[model samples]
Target: MQSNHDGKKPGLPEIVEILAVSVCFTYISGGEAVGAVGLLIAYATLRWGRS
Candidate 1:
C-alpha cells in the first residue's frame, strides 16, 4: 500500500495552487510589475530545481 507521506514533492496542481495564492497576494499588496516578477522568479526557481 502507498503511504500518504511518502516524502514526495508537491505535484503540478498543488504547485499551481500555491502560485495562484502567491501571485494574488503579491499583486494586491504590491502591483502588477511586482506580481509579474514574482511569478517569473517562481517559475525560474522551479525549473532550476527540477534540473
Candidate 2:
C-alpha cells in the first residue's frame, strides 16, 4: 500500500502536467479558460487533500 505522505513541493513536473492537460482540453483554442481550469484543478486537489 502507498504511504500516507505528501509531496515535498509542487515542482516542474506538476506544472508541466497541468499545462499538458490544459493544452489537451483547449486543443485549438488559447484563452483564460484553460488557465482557469488548470488553476481550479490545482486548488481543488489541494483543498480536497487536506480535507
Candidate 3:
C-alpha cells in the first residue's frame, strides 16, 4: 500500500483546503489585512514550491 504523508509539504487537496479556509477566514474577518496576508503566503508557497 502507498503510505499517505500529511506533512508540511502538503499536496493538491491540502492546498485547496488551505485556499478555501483562507477565503472563508478572509470573508469572516471583514478586512483586507488577514486575507491579504493569507493569500500572500499561499501564493508565495505555491510559486516557490512549484515542483
Candidate 4:
C-alpha cells in the first residue's frame, strides 16, 4: 500500500500535530511525569521541525 493514495498531503509534521495534542491532553488529564515529559518533547519537536 502506497503512503499516498489521495492527493498531495502534508506529511510528518501534520501527523505530529495529532501526537502533540494527544500528549498535551494526557498531561492535562492527570497523566504523570512521563506524560508531562512527553508533552514537553512534543512542543520541542514541533518548534524544532518548524524552523
By TM-score, the best candidate is: 3
Error of 3 at 1 (Å): 16
By TM-score rank, best first, the candidates go: 3, 2, 1, 4
Query: Tens digits of per-residue lDDT for model 4 on 1-51?
Result: 345525445478656866677677676959876777677666656644433
Worst 10 residues of 1 by lDDT: 1-10
Q: Ten-residue segment with the worst summed lDDT in candidate 4?
A: 1-10
Question: 1-51, model 1: which lDDT tens digit per residue?
Answer: 433434467678657866786777667757676767677567646753442
Question: Residue-wise lDDT of candidate 2 within 1-51, one digit each (tens)?
Answer: 443337555557666766676665565445568666876577648743533
lDDT by residue for model 3 over 1-51, one digit each (tens)? 433553357678767876776776677668576676777577656754543
Badly placed stretches (over 4 Å) of model 3 are 1-3, 6-8, 35-51
The pairs that clash in candidate 3 are none
Better lDDT candidate (1, 2): 1
Error of 2 at 36 (Å): 6.9
CA RMSD of all predictions: 6.3, 4.8, 6.5, 7.4
How many clashes show up per model? 0, 0, 0, 0
Q: Using alpha carbons, what is the TM-score of model 1?
A: 0.42
Query: Candidate 1, overall lDDT?
Result: 0.63
Choose the strongest candidate by lDDT.
3
